[model samples]
Target: MAMTLSTPPVPADWTRHTPFSDPGRHAELLEDVAPSPEAIGPVVRNLLAHYRAEGVNMPVSSRDDINLRWVEEMLSVDQERHPGRSLQDPRATEARLQGCCRDHTLLSVSILRGQGIPARSRVGFADYFVPGWHSDHVVAELHDGERWRRFDPEVAPESGLLPDPWDLEVGPGAPFTTAAEAYRALRAGELDAASYGVAPDHELSGDAFVLTEVFWELAHRYGDELLLWDGWGAIPAPEEEMSEDLLALLDEVAEQLIAADAGDKDAEQALHALYVRDDRLHPGERVLRFSPLGDGPVAVDLRRGEDAVTRPGIP
Candidate 1:
């Protein structure tokens, strides 16, 4: 499952951003931290200390969106020192000091790229956390010219929620999963998409939960991290809305994803091309806002390629 296969050279593009992972946007925040390219491990550790998950003691008003840049969220430990920063600016993330899983992963990916290491954040299920359910999560994947390594900078031993323990150099699962894996398993009826969630009572997970994340991860693999509020083509569309064409497309993506993980560069490129070709996944952009738990509707910006444009959280 957690086999370490040798890797080929990642295309240079992975070393930079695809709109979402842009580090240059917040150069000052990442300046001296991981100044050198080889300091990836230290960068991961630094972030783990800097962030606390959204639900843990953090107010709901402060923690909803996953689209934030690293600068503001990372530096919140001392905002008084760094005043007058925009919430969207990456520089402010450092001052804000906390975020959800994607935030941590993005910060790591952004910092790693700043150091010139080919890295990207991946979305999928993390099995090591909750038993029986594969909680939707994200982690950073870095290719150091020789092999691709996965790191989870979010949950550390002190996080208290990590009972199974996480291997920063390897990520979760005996064989960690991506959107493709979840798609194949769902299609095969091996696993229920609704079964995957942060917790059983959480409203975010539903019948189409896994499918939605599949498209999100697909978008990320293709160089963009379709925001948490983003909708991808017909992915989270209603059951009646899922066309035969989309199902066929999912099959193709699943196949390529398997090959991509197996060291097939061609397959990897095809996946990115397919994503770009379907511009449906790259809908313009959604400028939304985040609200806390008790602060009314929270105005959740849920886009399922569907009409309902609100969510309680990342579903």
Candidate 2:
């Protein structure tokens, strides 16, 4: 009779904000930033510019519809491209903000949860850019009050490809992998679900894009910090098909997200009670997205209450 669990909010309660990492009114542009990924990873790689790896040449209508899911609309489009500057200066990689790597991990988890620090965002599958593939990534974990590090604010420690892009080493020949550890290593065939995705000649990728990246790694670990091509609840539409009870409910959600990333508070309260009683695992009020700038599959509408200002495939 061993069953009685309910204590799961710790990790400094992720410092706060998760309507896609808030930062409203630009939260004073992360008030003097510095919760440390060596000062929030080069201010999120100089306020983002990786629309497709560093040598950013801009304009395919400005890096194809960058789905900026609120970090106050990516600091209001980086204050309309460097207006009052100083998100710690140094712009000019095509004046920044084109985004990818999940907008450099949701603006470095919204400046480390606006400096109170807890942080989040994981999604996963990196294998260092693309030699034998495994692309699909998104980093930032934070919580350094004594654990959870795993950074890579879109890799830039002179791109030696992480010996410590601020402490990475995720597991099994490490270089990150958590779409529930690449869906339990592609159901234990031990890897090669079409070499993992979105790059090695991008036609999306295999094992149903690692089962929609394990429902985008539990909707960015329960916070609903979405947009890794945002689809909604129970996420299965790239011509939907996987069913053997949805691959045994994503193999018990990739074994409780790898035992709640190895700390396992009853596997993080059974993955927060199966992501709040599973409405196909969370994300209601509309989702569909898919636009890698082509703006095809829209739907969006996430309520947008408090006088919402626009975030449906951000043109």
Q: For every model in order, what is the number of clashing pairs?
A: 24, 1
- Please estimate how well model 1 matches the true structure, expressed as its whole-model Cα lDDT: 0.55
Encode model 2's per-residue lDDT on 1-315: one tens digit a residue.
Answer: 111223235532566667677777878777677667777788877887877775347666566537777778788887887788778889878777787888778788777666666678888788887788878888888766556888888787887877788888767888888888778877888877888888875778887888778887777776777778878766677778877887888899889889878887787777777766778877777788888777668988866687342221111
TM-score for candidate 2, please give it.
0.33
Whole-model lDDT per candidate = 0.55, 0.75
Q: Mark the 10 consecutive residues where model 2 has the least summed lDDT.
A: 306-315
The global Cα lDDT (0 to 1) of model 2 is: 0.75
Off by over 4 Å in 2: 1-8, 11-13, 16-27, 31-46, 51-93, 97-103, 106-108, 115-118, 125-135, 139-177, 181-187, 190-192, 201-256, 259-264, 268-315
TM-score for candidate 1, please give it. 0.71
> What lDDT score goes with residue 97 in model 1?
42
TM-score of each: 0.71, 0.33
Query: Which pairs clash (backbone N, Cα, C closer than 3 Å) in model 2?
Result: 234-280
Cα deviation at 216, candidate 2, in Å, is 15
